[model samples]
Target: MRPNYLVIILLIFYSCNKIETRDEVYPTKLYEKAKYFQNENISDSAFYYFNLAKNDYVKINDSTGASKSLVNMAIIQCNNGDFYGSIETSLEADKLLRNESDSTVKSTLAANYNNMAISSSFLKNYEESVAYYKKTLQFSNDAENRYIYNNNIGDALILLGQYKEAKKYLELAIFTKDSLIYAKVLNNIARAKFLDDQNYNPLPELNKALIIRQNNKDIEGQNSSFSTLADYYLEKNAEKSLLYSYKLLETSEKIKKPEDQINALQRLIMLDKPNYLKYFKRLTAINDSTQTSRNKAKNQFAVIRYDVEQKDAENKNLKLRDAENEINIIYLSFGLGILIITLIIGHFWNEKRKKSIKIEKEKEKELEVKNTELRYSKKVHDKVANKVYHVMSELENTENMNKEVLLYKLDGIYQISRDISYDKNDVALEHNFSQHLSQMLKSYSSENIKVPIIGNEESLWEDVGDHSKVEVFYILQELMTNMKKHSKADKVLLDFSRENDLINIVYSDNGIGISEFSPKNGIQNTESRINSIGGTINFDTKTENGLKITLSFPAKN
Candidate 1:
């Protein structure tokens, strides 16, 4: 009886305190205020306060609050045409939340990549956009994020002229559980296939997207699908297209997406045919702007390629001139040697003819001296040259020796055998050299290498002597074998022809090429083999194709 009023007073005070506690615990006043500015499309104030609240949440270590703020800021940036800037902020948020092991960070990354892809599409950098969207697909772990990223990739691929690949990605997107994302992917696929002359229409996909948006009460998505579909049908059904376009225009105006409104207005002009001159002017203006931008980019890429080609051509010309000078020096040396030998022979012949009566005793002395020198020269050539050749061939095949090592060996061999020659009087060098070359090619081909020898039956050597045939065959064999082992070719054709006194052997193949012809064993051997007969070899590597070997020989009487 003494405490009844006191207990009643205490109970009232406790109830009021509990209400205050609840209010302090859930203080959504700032969030509500920010949402108002966002809904009003006032981006400047919305971004400022969102940052303020996001910083406060970070100070309090509130990850959920921080994430919401970041998402809202990103959406605002996307609406304001600062797409790349938005992606930068989104990635920062993603990194923070990923360190916290948040699952939603993956979805956020997918969203950022998708936004980047859309911006890049507007820029018409399809390759770069497709690459970004692929990263989105890789990071999107959940079904919904996967569906969105897949659609993003599909759209980029379509713009890149990769319609076949786009179709597969789009179909996979549509099969996902997120009906809204699935519908968007389907629309992209259908439009892409239609543009590519494939058997698919976008109307069904657009309608499906509309259905999902309507059911979910997603007005923005509904407006986008309607606008796209109406623009699509504008060509075939003018009245229906106009009706849909009007609906989209009204919805877009309410949502305050000015770009979508502009698009809808353009479509209306197309379908209704009202203000025809104005529509034509707008389209012309857009086209001119687009073409100007495209020309700038195309010119930039072309300039890079042109500069590279110019440098390459300049280098090649210098090399060719040096090679020509070397060849001239070699020819001059051979001419001088031949002239000296000829004069000596003529002098001796004249002396012998003039002294024929006295030379009977002198002839015996001359014969013995000539025989001794010939025997000594044969012994040196057979033993020293054969042993050197065997050692060089062994070094050439070893993996330990690099290209420079092999080149050094070939140069050494050239210096050592500088005086060797295939003269007409060498009977061993005279034979069916074309047949011998074909047999070598056949052996290479039997080892599962693609080596084809053509023009062997057609004889360019019909009138040429044995020395010429031997030199030509040796050079041809070396060139063909080099092409087979190094060129990685599937087919090789060798053409031999003779025009008057000059004989030509042309060897070409469809394989990887030598850019400007780096000197290899095959090349050195062929060059040495040709030089032995006083012939020349010229070869070139065509860009991205294969090697072309040309051999020229002077026919003897």
Candidate 2:
């Protein structure tokens, strides 16, 4: 007969209700697979699948499914001899259960608590086990469950030396018509009566239960009956006690329960002195190995749970990163769409204004030919032409142009064209030059492309002249646009460094190199602007892997 510690493990699985899964695959399939393995006695595989099912249930917000899976996992742990781990796992299931719930959930909650009680009993925490059995009864609505919990509570109370209270619950348990359950309770009642009052004769009830257990072929029940009878006869009849003790040890070994075998050996060592040394050695051996088995069980279960937790955390982190990346892509695309629309409208409006000015000038030339020609030429060059050409050039160069900047430039041109004599030379000085440079390079990034910037801190640009900053800004801007348009590149990197009074930038892209480099703007604009700021630009067009352009310039005048 297995120890009563194994009794609760049986109690739970027999009575617990499985959560009904109506065709949904994810959690339901996992639950089914776990059940198949559990029924097949593949405990490790069962625990693994049940844990997976619990995680899946949590993801879908099915509290009932998660609780059921946890309960089953706890039972598996109990069966595997990991009593502490079993109690911990059962508590996890309890957290998922509600205090007041539907009948099915109530039944689940009862079974979960019952598992805790059984595992606690095995660990010799009888007070805690009694408390847990009472909790199990609290959720139980079924009369059969009431009987079961009563018997369990009685068993634990007997362990605590409360024989009178143990008999009270055992009497309630004996009211059941179940012959097997009746036999179990009858033995407990007999043990309690004899324990509480040494004068009380329990042989009749004990013998009757033993007969019923034998008739039913209840091996665990017979194991209990043998133990109870042997203890009862130990003080009164030495010969009968020795006979029952031998039977207990034989039956315990047949069932292969180390705890029961230990109990039986203990009785024999006390009763039969001839083989005391032999029985003592076997008892010691089993005791040592039992603890080893328990520790091994605890470690194996702990490792399995720990590994699953780590994998779940990794999966969640990966999902969170994916979600964030998707959101960024959406924002970038939306901003790009708005920018393109603004540029299109701005371009058409500017073209219309320039056309209107030329027509007016032509009409005036017919009336005051010489005067209008001179006035028209001066006004168009000074106000209408330069400011409009500036706006158009800025529009052409900047793709992700800021709305406020575009609006400011257009308003400047509008006012300048109206005054025709306000020649305000805009230097385009920016206080936060480093930030602007960083944003410009990063704006080119897409889902398929990565733009990583390095060492472009504000401190690096501190001593740089405004003319140099502005020229470098546009120079870098041109390179980015050029790469996007023709490089077919997937990666772009800009590494910046400084040496005392000079700032150096090396721009690279993993794209088809300068063999396909078609330089537009015959003016050599990049070279001219670099030289104006005491800067030199070098292009390595020989590499096949990508483009590497190095620009070195004095940080200050």
Candidate 3:
């Protein structure tokens, strides 16, 4: 066993959480005094001081302190026999401590759950006891806590008549270094085994555990052993069972354990038929007293928390009203200042601003008309004029090209010109773009003009955006239109290559390079496209053989 294992065992099994209190603070002082009363076994005074401390913690918005105080009050409530009230108080503490994971907060939470589990066990809510015990294990840092919690869960399961499942946990709980723990496990294990199979012998284990508890003078252990043994021999040896019952009653009364007293009286009522009525009367009196005490304890705990809640609710209402009044005053002042500013600004500059806006609108209207005319002119020349010239070259080149193919091309050109004003692009130029581009460049080829395109692989179009591809298509189409009309170039070469995300195009011809280097509207339209894609264009008309136009742009939009 590790050094701190005992400390952890004490913390878990005995619920010994170290109270941290600051003497300088009144709330902490109250908490310290509450701890003193709690240690002295003055529960009502402890509950009073803890309630005061909780309200103080709430006033300061110290949720951790408030939750810790509540956990302490809940334990006191459970010890006072208010099981249901303890469960409610522990749940309230858990709400305050939710989403907190620091070590101290976790420790407080573990204590909170352990209290609930104990209260649940007392309430005969074995299922709830098992559930809360498992939840307690989840927060406990000590691995050795498994022995304690697993045994508790097993005990609950035994009462639930889940004997087979009960033994599984009890088997793991035989950590023998702790004698009381081992004896507790041994008693429960024998009970579970005997309950599971009537023919199974439990006396050896049962007597062994009873002897260990007797030697240790463990009052709770002795009570458990006394009850188990009396029940086991109730039919077999009534005299022996009655002896354990009298011992149980004597010990229970000496220790002020009313629950154990009730159990012992019931056994005596059944085994001692001659004195049955006397034991039954005693049983009735003790039962009434225990019930009255439990009820009083429950009411006391509830009323304390309820009073705090009522005061806190009233405080919230008062704060909300004060905040509302301050907000209304601020809003009134802000409204008046905004109204004055609005009137002054409206009187001084409203007409001048209106006049300025009208002049700007008129200028924008004029520029929009000019831009519209320029776009229309460019689209018509690019989509109509260039397309018609390319068709003319196709007709002149093909010996017997069918009229249907010719009509389709002309109809496509017609639709483009018709929708040119509304259309932002020539739809889907990126579909099989490489093959389409190759076909378009080579279409301008005739017997005299050998236009060979290089590096027109399909993969070059991989990362290129649709809009950029459309612009590049238009630029190339405009260049081809000019080459066919004016450049008078033969044996034109179009080279394409890619560097990372950039596309590079090189165009050259063997004949008739431009001398003056002047570009018309079609050439200017190509220049605009190059600039639009944020690319560079270089026209080397002074090249030895022909005009060399080089361009580079981003492959993606």
Candidate 4:
């Protein structure tokens, strides 16, 4: 009895193991069933089984198997006119097979690219389709796939109006040993030639392709050949065109491709047959049905993708919420510790901030006092010292004392001192600044010297601030004094212009320029005044060319 019980137990364990093994192999069986249905042209069943296989493979983490199913599903989706869905599925397969090394895996990768090319072509994305076909060529080591991809790329180029480029790839496909592929390439080349020039006859190549398709019993190829021949003969030979168009319609219906059937029916309608209205009605019906099916398929695909993305987002949100809860607990604990430390450090930081503020205020006060002293010194130097120096020079040069000239000089000095004391040195601001500036320039002119002023419109000085006006007046005075005393300039040009918010002044003189001179008191004073007004001055000097100075500043209103 014990021996019998052991045998029963061992049998039950073996049965359980066998069931587990069968479960493990189920995805491969599902993939095979999908392939069988796809070959039979039962697309609905094929899609159902392919999805099943894909989900099963994904459950087992079998990426290669899932990719294979996905590629096939993408092809079916493309045929059903779900081009956007097909593209997404093909990209998913491409990601899975990116690092695969097996020869079969490589073939699948090539097929994935080819499927993407076909889908893009149907969507009228000719350039992207051509790019995907080229990618297909890169992975396609087999001659069959290479020839097919070359032909597909060439056809897409022809559609894009690149007949010359299309001929090159078509010729490559023509080199294949497969007669069917060679015939297809020849037909495409002939069509490209005919389209490029209507005078070219494509009938010879069409006849050759037709013969090959008929011999091979390839219904789809026959349909394509008949359609091309019918279009080629439509204007030249109406009867022959009608016969081929009818043949194309028959073959298309036999192949059960609604798009092809509608195309053939439309061609027949264009032939002006006795039953033209009948063909037109049939064409309309088939076209409407085809469009409806495509729209339904696209909608279905979109719904499925939306649902998948939504579920994925929901799952991600759940995971993030769980992680956030755990992190919040840790952060709360850490925050309490950080808060205590921050309170301790903040007290010290507050004391340091107060000390820093006090030091900054002291520095600011010192800067203000120094600035006040500098302003007083500049006023005395410009107003008192300069006038005193001129008086002393006049006294030394004169042998007899001229009371009127001395009194006139003394009165000018007293007025200048009063202007400096009141900080109202800009006499030009009392009248038109441009006219005053012109009068000042004329003062620097003599029998041997010429001063040409240009672009000095009164409007240009309208935006000058009071302080900037005073500084500018002093700067010009210093420059003219330097030129009169040292430059020996015969001609001077002063141009002033306002652009946007900036005032530009160009001062140039033809003089016996200094070879290399340091800044004298006059030049130093000019620079200081310009700096006080926030203006820039640049000097261009050469012994032969004299000196040119450009000054610019932001116009202050």
Candidate 5:
């Protein structure tokens, strides 16, 4: 009796491992042909093909192909509202592909991480989404892929209520070379800005995103951009929101994406409940077709499973002795398989080394080009532009100088030279932080403007790059220009300090404070520019003196 029980247990275990299926020629034919399905509206068939491909790859021992198929299936699952299932499948693929050092494999791994993040987003697990997106950045080295991953990271952070961090990553992603990524990053940033209460209006960021999407002719991106802008203006400008929603509906129709069309129609319905019936009917038809197709595919899968089970039973009954003899042959085949795998591993290692060398050379070439551009710009500013300014200065200071005449002539020359040299090179300000502050103070030392400078010069320029120096210059220019024009302050003090990784800049004047002022056009422009550079600005209006502005930024490299 005990021996019989042990045999029964073994049989149950083998049965559990077996794939149950139906016994019918039509079902088998359908199962095989299902692998070729690729209909946009038929999410079920697409999902079925994805699973078939994954199983096919596993049978062939192709890890990379299996991972790809799994990712594709997860994408469809995400679209069909099975977000948790999608996340699980993506995680399994990620684990299998992690050991692969191939860039193409790594790219797929990054994509899996991105899909997992999207699934997490559907579940409203913002923190987990952010964590997975961060993982994507680690695996993705391709510039275009990195750009999208960075933007997704920003979007996830924004959803987590980390506005400042979201903006920082979004700026980096937008600064990337890919236009599609740039446009998408801009849209995400706009959403973040809209969420931040500090921003009175986030229309500018939305407009910037719209312009970029339109310029790149990204229809999907454009659809998103228009929808966002429409929602944004819905509260403040109802007419504008309605107009953009209608425009988005037209674009969605042109693109022929049913889901997007459904979204646009829904948004239009919200704006105009009376006219929405036209779009609503179309949306319902598409949605119904999608659900029907998915149901049919699910039913077919059940049929295939039943047929496969019957075939396994018949094959097992007819080949019991043959399978026992083949067991020894399987052991022999496994031994040779291990040896072949070892050789393949060795080949892959050498190939990876060669690719790394090529990548290094390309990076070096890019860095060289950037350095050459900076050097050329420095030469033009230091030699050509500076000399012209000096000659004009001497002419103005001469004994019989015509002040008005010299001033007008110098202004034209300055404008013309600036235009000519603008593309040649960027102007580098004084590298010493203290000297830069002093120059700013001197520039505002006229009868109407008084700015006292305070900062140290020790080692400020030692490790800093031209990028940081230029940012400081632009900040100073904007601040002083604001003070001179609007502050009405007769006295101003500028303070600067560097502590650890942070740089602090304080500008205060004895003029009219910010309470007496609204967001000046200049202030708005400055705010946008400063945000683009990943810096924060706080306006202290409680001061009885002039407006006090505090600027903090990460030290430039």
Candidate 6:
């Protein structure tokens, strides 16, 4: 009993799947239905089904199926007088079949090229039509299609007024086994010859073509032959011309071709017939009706394309929205994970930063204590020790030392200590420090030495800070004192120039240059003062040339 129940359940599932499959319509079936409607001359129904088949094939990734449907729809559009629309559809089919290997697809591509040629001809683009017809011949392997395309090229060339060139393709088309196409080519060649030369007689060829079309029961071909014959006799034989025009009108009416009917009516009106007014009214009515139908067909095609595009856009938007939703969910999860990890790291980083700051504060306190001790030692050496040495030298010279000399030495000691304790210097920080520097250099100069100052411009020191100005004064004073005591300099050149944010001072003297001289107290003191004000000094001295010192420091604004 359990086995029986399982078998029934499986059968029910299979039945349901079969029903779902049967409900779906295949692209091939849709294409067949479109072809049937196209052959029945129901253009709207044909276009509707062809578009449906094209969309279905695209969904299934079947490019060949879609291309075939596009070609058929192009034919319908051309018949409805939508030449531009037909050309676009044919081009789309050609693109889809570019790399196709199937013989049927190749044949369809050739047919599509031919359709584009025909549509271009109707649009009066004769040159483009001829080019498209040549392309059709290149892709066509069938003799009949090749002959037909050659004839099409010939007709377009004749319309372009190339009578001599058109003869080649017309003669090629005349060799086809298809009697109807052969007859049409004969008529076109006759027209080309007639237009090429005024004395050319096309009556024989035109009459032969008309008889052949009649025998083959080719109604469209017969209509074309009659029209050509009418045009041929229009200027030569009025009676024959009237007769052919009437015959064309009768044939066009029988076939329900309004364009042909209108052309015949216009020819009849031009002939000054007895019932010209009646034919004129009929021509106007047929032209209006034809134009209305063409407009309706164009609008219908536009609406169908719009609807398809709207549906495709809606489907694409739905897919994009779904993808965005998934991306947002992923971002939310990732953001939460990053936030939790950042919080954990930040907690530990805060504790580590606190410990580092505490250690930095203890080191700063130790550095401050060491700096204070160094400052006190420098003060003692500069003040008390130097003053005590001066006192001992005075005591050693006891014969020359008196009460006045002792008082003078004590006063000098008091002045040295006072200078160390004070922050200000009366002479060094004076506004006339530049004058004092000039006088000091002049005092070192004598009859044997020359000191040439290049720049004594007051503006050079205008941007210099007070502390830097005092250092500069003392440095120059110390250099001059050394030159007088040791270096027997002949000439000195001092140049000062301010560039950008720096001051450059160059000092060169022609003196007996010391080769291995050690820096004494004056030189050491000059280096310390220069460094305190963020300045640099370079000394250049050779065996006998001279001493050239180059000094550069930042000019404080």
Using lDDT, give the best candidate's number.
3
What would the C-alpha RMSD of candidate 6 be, to one decimal place?
35.2
Per-residue C-alpha lDDT of model 6 across residues 469-502, encoded as one tens digit per residue: 8667667766765675567888988898886578
lDDT per residue, candidate 1, 432-456, as tens digits? Answer: 5566557655654533356666666
Which clashing pairs does model 6 show?
none
**For model 6, what is the error of residue 244's alpha carbon versus the real structure, in angstroms, after optimal superposition?**
0.8
Error of 6 at 389 (Å): 99
Q: How would you encode candidate 3's per-residue C-alpha lDDT over 1-557 as one tens digit per residue?
A: 23235334443443222223323347998999999999999998899889889888987888988999999999999999988778888999999997557888888888898899999999898888899888888888875676888899899999999999999999989865798899999999999999999999999999999899999999889999999989988888999999999999999999999999999999999889999999999999999999999888887777776786788789779856865665555446556665666677676678888899999999999999998898789788877888888888888878898999999999989888878878765653735888888778887888888888899898898978777787788888877777887777778889999966889999888768877688878788888888888898889977667688998999876
How does each model score on lDDT?
Answer: 0.65, 0.82, 0.85, 0.81, 0.69, 0.80
Evaluated at residue 97, the lDDT of candidate 5 is: 88
Name the runs in model 1 displaced over 4 angstroms: 1-46, 49-72, 88-108, 118-126, 198-218, 234-243, 277-557
TM-score leader: 2
lDDT of candidate 5 over 1-557, digit per residue (tens): 33335445655555455435433223233334444554445766756656655655665577787788778767767766667767877877876685657887988888898899888986889888889889888888878777777788888898788988998888878878877777788788878877776455777767887888888788888898888888788788878888988888789889866666777777777788778787678778978976675555444544443454566567767667654555445445455655566577768878998999999999999999997776455444433544454444355445687779677757755664665545543343435555754764575576545566777465544455556656556556666666665667888887878755677788888887776446754466456545645778888988776678898777654
TM-score of each: 0.38, 0.55, 0.52, 0.49, 0.45, 0.53
Q: How displaced is residue 171 in candidate 6, in Å?
A: 0.7
Per-residue lDDT of 445 in model 6? 66
Q: Kindly give the stretch of ten consecutive residues in candidate 5 with the minimal lDDT sum.
A: 22-31
Clashes of each: 1, 0, 0, 0, 12, 0
Top-down TM-score ranking = 2, 6, 3, 4, 5, 1
Give the alpha carbon lDDT tens digit for every residue of 240-354 in model 4.
Answer: 9889888989988998888778878888888867889999889888878888898888776555555655765787698568656755554465566656666787888899999
In model 3, where is the ten-residue run with the lowest total lDDT?
A: 14-23
At residue 361, candidate 6 shows an lDDT of 95
Off by over 4 Å in 6: 1-25, 100-102, 313-557
Instruction: Give the lDDT ranking, best first.
Output: 3, 2, 4, 6, 5, 1
lDDT per residue (tens digit) for residues 221-252 in model 2: 89899988888888889899889989988988
- Residue 413: error of model 2 in Å? 85
Stretches of candidate 3 exceeding 4 Å from the true structure: 1-26, 306-557
